[model samples]
Target: MEGKSWIFKNRPAIVASGVVGGPFEQKSPYSGEFDLVKDTLWMEEESFEKANRQLIESAIQVTLDKKTLSSNDIDALLMGDLINQITPTSMAARTLSAPYLGLFSACATSMEGLALSAALIDGGYCQKVLTGASSHNAAVEKQFRYPTEYGGQKPPTAQWTVTGAGVALIEKASPHNAPLALIEKATIGKVVDNGIKDPFNMGAAMAPAAADVIERHLNQTNQTIDDFDLIITGDLSRIGHPITEDLLKQKGIAFKSGQFLDCGKMFYPELPDVQAGASGPACSAMLVYSHFLNELQKGSVRKILSVATGALLSPLTFQQGESIPCIAHAVELSSPAVNSQSFRGEE
Candidate 1:
């Protein structure tokens, strides 16, 4: 790894992915891409948190079923969620037979898991890894803010938590399995805080971190925005999307028209009551693993840079009057059709 970035020479491949969403997500324009859609958020479970865990389990099971593999075939499991201590993800991992590693980066946990999965395979330490992130609307809201029954008024900056889970099976590159996308590079982010204390304004809190990592990733890799067919941010939503664009512009970095977008903003463009749009760990995960992966497979986009951002503020921290610290993790992905000439690193 060189300066917070890892250029994978072997190019780990995301062979298969699974996305499970709640009934609310059924209205999303990309709902057709989901592997499974539960008719209710309860998911036949007793509590919302249990339902949250079920989402992760269902997503992982779907991914395994797609490849006709089982837990015995998985080398490791890296998963996370937005619940306190990420209990939902840990509880779900308990049911899995493979070695498990729980991760947390607020909304950015998805890319964090993917980056580590690619690193493990690229370093020849593991053959196959299950990595994912999940978020539940009710469970996260109850923990992070007021309960759904509170009837509290929210500002337009507030983003709705996505009720979904996205899991992927990443493995060593191979000739037999034509993977969806290849992981070429990953740029880990540094924490950035601008003294933003309102949890409802997560987009504003995370925007700077996203821009910082993007600039660093391009500089360290000697690449430009033109190198990628698309550059997508995790859950910046409508508010942070423009802020990020302006920040990049001030830094003298410009993107081609239609070259940049935010998964949060696009996740539920038409859904009502989604004030700023979607914001959660699953926001980016669901979009990338489902719609964007299909785009790569269909050759619609040859290369993509995904930057997943996170606002690292707990309820306790907020209650104690601490500012929200934010981070963003970037992963470079390309269609398998792209040749080795596009990959960088010491081979």
Candidate 2:
């Protein structure tokens, strides 16, 4: 494939999606777009990790319900989260009883699943695959930083982990079913460590990796900045978003501010105490599956390049004074209307 980028010949279609969020996410500007919103993180579970698993299960249920399908209809389930060893996702898989593959890419887990789902469908390996990612604020905070109960203070660079889950039901394109969007291409990023060790400032550490993938995706796919209606990043927030823009310009690819946006910065514009906006596997998944897909369905936007970034460092690695290694995966999507036509980058 051209330097970690692959063009999906079959153009796997995203048929349906479901997003669930907690009380913290209810305040998000796009909260109404979510299929379900729980008033508390617990969701009647005894622990936050259990609650995280509940979120994933709920999201999967919502996705299946939207398409009027059951877990038995799903050929495979791919998902992950930020918890240790991604136990929450595995437990959810256990409940679903579907052939499952648990993934781990820190916050970038969502697009990683989506990319592989498209590849599998394009290659004729599977028919229908359920892929997604989830995260819990309290669960992740307790593992990465201090528990919310401890009232630990954070710097302005620290981002608030989102409490949410998002899943998508993807399958081979069919004349019988209309698609929400078509997965056109995918670019897998290389690991990039900027020598930053602070767990709080994840945006800075992930910015370079995001830029690297975006540049590679554009160049390898023979596209330009103008090819996409939007190029959105997973988190990166207020601090890292600008850093990514600057880095892209240095690489001979520049775009206007409106052309590029970050899910973290847009998720909680009016909310308070989110110093650097949202950061979690759910951040990008929730946004793309809900808002951006809805926009495509409404014909407001036709094409998008979504880059979900991840910090590969675990608590042990950071605690041991290791710099964070970051990565990003880019997935190009086109509206169903555009999918009917012969479309490619600038001739």
Candidate 3:
């Protein structure tokens, strides 16, 4: 059977209740302005399970406040995170009263959840879906990169894992609710391995996968880079972003210099000094919640295509001589001009 379309032509109604959590008071390798490298609010636990629980609880609180929703009111909770067996997300869901669905797309998990929830609402599956993703700096480091205490010097292209979470409530399109943005079109990525095997060099490993999706998205939608105000790449970092662009140019596609931005670059630009860029699930989530969502609300930018990229590889698999498998999911965001009228009346 053909895959279902994740993009919405009529534009779905979604509100990012806002994000909660940061690398505060956590025992981590980073310090200073970029000290919050843990990318999460929970640092009280040494075990991944405990940290995951804390992260989920924080996300749930944010969702409740933003939507004015109680745990019993939500139809379903769709969540994911980067961890073995997705333990963090699973544990967090156990505390919630809403039915839960777990997903795994590495870094792209947030976008994937948003896309699927939008599709479900669009198909009349239900209304009021909550989707979120989180990442812990310590756990990710221990699993993928070196130990948090290793203190090894990173390459220029390496991206710091953000310790953060983002939650968005997706509802049926309506005339009243804020029309945050819709998934206009999406080009799902196939697993691509170019034989680059360094776990630390994720940018290089995932660049080809990013290039493939960019090519296919433009081709399938018949939209060029200029069609949208911005073409944002999730967590590819500085190094992978350029590599993806260079490869795209070779394929006869070109994006304006300022037109392209990386979520990794937007976070921790002053600290961590990531030569290449930022990586991790929180990298993209924080960028979307903190930067893009704010811009859409303020009418700074009307249309945007945010693509979250992921390197779908485990340390065990990489150690077993497996090449990196990467994927990306694209979501479009637009301003809610129609809903703003309601706010005007209240003012």
Cα lDDT tens digits, model 3, 138-224, are: 678777777778987886767777666777788765655665654455566677788887877888788888788777777777678
TM-score of each: 0.97, 0.97, 0.87
Relative to the true structure, how large is the alpha-carbon lDDT of every model?
0.91, 0.91, 0.72
- Clashes in each model (backbone N, CA, C under 3 Å)? 0, 0, 8
**Model 3 Cα shift for residue 83 (angstroms):** 0.7
Query: Per-residue alpha-carbon lDDT of model 1 for 265-322, expressed as tens digits?
Result: 9999987699999999999999999999999877788999999999999999999999
lDDT of 2: 0.91
User: How much does candidate 2 score in TM-score?
Assistant: 0.97
Better of 1 and 3 by TM-score: 1
- Locate the minimum summed-lDDT window of 10 residues in model 1: 338-347
Give one digit per residue, the lDDT tens place, for model 2 in 65-141: 98889889999998999999899999999999999998999999999999999999888889899999999999998
Residue pairs that clash (backbone atoms under 3 angstroms), model 2? none
